[model samples]
Target: MPVTDITTDAENLTMTLVADVAAPVDRLWRAFTQPAQLERFWGPPGWPATFTRFDFTPGGRAQYAMSSPQGEKSRGTWEFIAIDEGRSFEVLDAFADENGEPMEQFPAMRMLFSFETTENGSRLTNVTYFTSAEGLEQVIAMGAIEGSRLAMGQLDAVVQDLRAYAQGQGTRVELLDDTHVRITRFIDGPRELVWRAHHETELLKKWMLGPDGWTMTVAEPATDVGGTFRYAWEQEGAPETAFGFEGELLQLDAPRREVTTERMSGVEGPGTVNDLQLYEEDGATLLTLLIEYPDKETRDTVLATGMADGMEDSYARLEAEVLSK
Candidate 1:
């Protein structure tokens, strides 16, 4: 289960799980709808299981007995409410006592599983709907959160294995058009040090700019409104290393916050509009850089070149250098 979107409202708890399996939707559906396939990865890992019965159809029931590591046995049941071949299925689940009776008057949960096909593979989503707040609370008290997470982890493993078996290949990273990347570092230094490392030329040279072999030519700062600055970098044994911007200091509110826009150019780009913002938090500073390109193609191209990773590494180095001082 991918567990993509999870939310809780004033009255109900909803969770959506997504998975991209190697096999088609029909195969994936069978694996979920068949009792034998589900028992393989249904329970928490390392727990002794005794699945008393399983009937996969509308109005059917599934009963399972599981024993913890400490030898405590627990039982549960799912009443199948609806079924859709190769598309979706819904069930109402609850805990059962020793006599196979529901102990608590909890709400009936409806879990719907849907499958869709993509060029790369299949997309499977599991949407779970809780009836009421009290029903959601009752499951939480029974440690449902952790249990559900463990179940999803198991499901992911199963999907990975099935995909590998079906495709006769290993897992591959699929990059989508709309992928967002952000990095954050916690620096144990004065907020001023971190702030200056980005804004001041002298301080930037100490950390932001690379070592001596790397020549940082420009050191211009416009501290007021409409002020412009640019810095050029060149490495000794490498091609002319250059990435700078010609932009205005839209706002400079001191050590607390600052915002700037720059039109960057060089090896990485012909030109890109960049916006940077800084915020102070708990004696530390949080810096955010937002790059806006002319189009999605440009953004995807930049991302493919690992620019985000490079930026993250540079910021990590800056954090270490600032704290060392």
Candidate 2:
């Protein structure tokens, strides 16, 4: 059900195609604007496209060519007219020569692209308008309708991958210093909810426990400046191996930044300093955690505890159980 509807009006000299895609407006818009992504889906099933230029702005230009299996190449160009960031845009599309020069005899048309949010996801609309009915008939007779439908159908899977990568389905770990590890990820939730998940006892308990078989029994989060915070979790039916973190709040700013001094549940050495920063991007939260260890050995110990996997699991649970609500 990629291409939901295709309406062709010979009298009005217009053809509109619609697709209900399972992606956010921003993500789908990027796929439509970015050169690397447009190359993946701008052509039909057998013919793959190669984008040579992509300037998604007013008075900009996008040039690409589709190469068929038998070494045949078809070039095209789009002269952008208007753009509304992540919402909509208008362009004049036409056939082009190998050097991206527009061909005079080809059917040149103005096309409007819109990405609108819907109950299920985003609804994408592509409307092509010609100056005269005869011009519309010329393109329609060339199988433009079926070709456009096939081209748009390839967008679903690429959009899904882009969505997942943005939501921390991939790893993003960087080392700032010898004794520090920084992890950044985009959580599929609002900034306020993600901030609350880190400070509220009940909300923290829903996702902070390492894996599925463990539970956080005691979570006392002192969210005020200079307050002491404590948390505890243990494997089910094995209370002897409980573990968590106790820390003191160094700074407090709701839904934005927080700094704390934390010690592992029962480590024999020094504690770590954690600086958590949250930023809102297009209605989602970007979380950055800076963990500082007193020594390189301590940092290595923390990383060896499967820290990345556990953190990813917790964030996944937070998205599904807390934020999605």
Candidate 3:
């Protein structure tokens, strides 16, 4: 286990766990902040976690559930209280219901995670503060210490696997559920630049072109909530083969996340909801797009269009044509 020490103080009503990770602070931070990576080891060996929602900014909330082999589920919620980017963060952790609301019978705890460079690599100091000594004892009696140790023990494999989440892996797609799909691409650029490339007309025109023979004709982009945008692309010298998309921004959190409704230009009825999130670590950014379709048919139909391959082409162009320059 990576956890070197586990201690409790009844007088202060706190429990502290110190772990030494064999990776840089930035890598460790990414493993925790990114939902794709966090889910791998958030729970103990048999119980695996799935994060339904992860908003890493202050005042935001994360909801997750750990499922056991016996089909029992333990739900939890994290209300982000404070964040010092790359260094530390604090959250109100509580046992939650199926809907992710905190349960009245369980007491909430304030947990602080601090990261720092160490001789071997980095150190993680996790401190849980309870309202009373009884609360602390209650958590310990529930096997909190053992569960945490086993969970952290699995961290070594995750952080060392650079090939999984690093740049140059191209676009990856995962079917999250019947109506949800997630796509991820690691960009060799900062978060701000990546976000700007998707919004600024000039930058978008340069790299948003999917294939070598295509050109972007319309590059209108929406950077504000409720604003509409349109984009069209055509093969070189073939205007008749042109296609376009139109969308209205639903939410915008600059340099972090955005949500929009997307559909083919002039199409009516339902459309897909796209949630785009960006996280930067060690000068590189991970761009995650979570798409929610109207149904499984629409989701599968879209994937069958070679969308993942096209996204990879565009992302490669983004690094070479926009970020490199």
Q: Model 1, 1-325: lDDT tens per residue?
A: 4444444454447755566655566666766777655654466542324567778789988888765422466877888888887787788877788865565865567888788887766776777788776776666678666565555544543444432322222112222224322223444455677777777887665555544455556767677877787766667666556656566676554664444555664444344444343434345444534444556777678778865545554565676666575
* Regions of model 2 farther than 4 Å from truth: 162-325
* Candidate lDDT values, in order: 0.58, 0.80, 0.86
| Candidate 3 clashes between residue pairs 3 or more apart in a chain or in different chains | none
What value does the lDDT take at residue 234 in candidate 3?
A: 98
Tens digits of per-residue lDDT, candidate 3, 1-325, equal: 5889999999999999999988999989998888988876798754567899999999999999986533468999999999999999999999999899999899999999999999999989999999998899899999998899878876875687543445566788877568878687888889999999999999999999887899999999996777999999999999998999998887665877677889998778788888787767678887878788899999999999999988899999999999999
Stretches of model 1 off by over 4 angstroms after superposition: 11-13, 156-325
Which window of 10 residues has the lowest lDDT sum in candidate 3? 160-169
What are the per-residue Cα lDDT tens digits for candidate 2 across 296-321? Answer: 88888779888888888888888888
lDDT rank, highest first? 3, 2, 1
Q: Return the top candidate by TM-score.
A: 3
TM-score of each candidate? Answer: 0.45, 0.50, 0.59
Q: What is candidate 2's TM-score against the reference?
A: 0.50
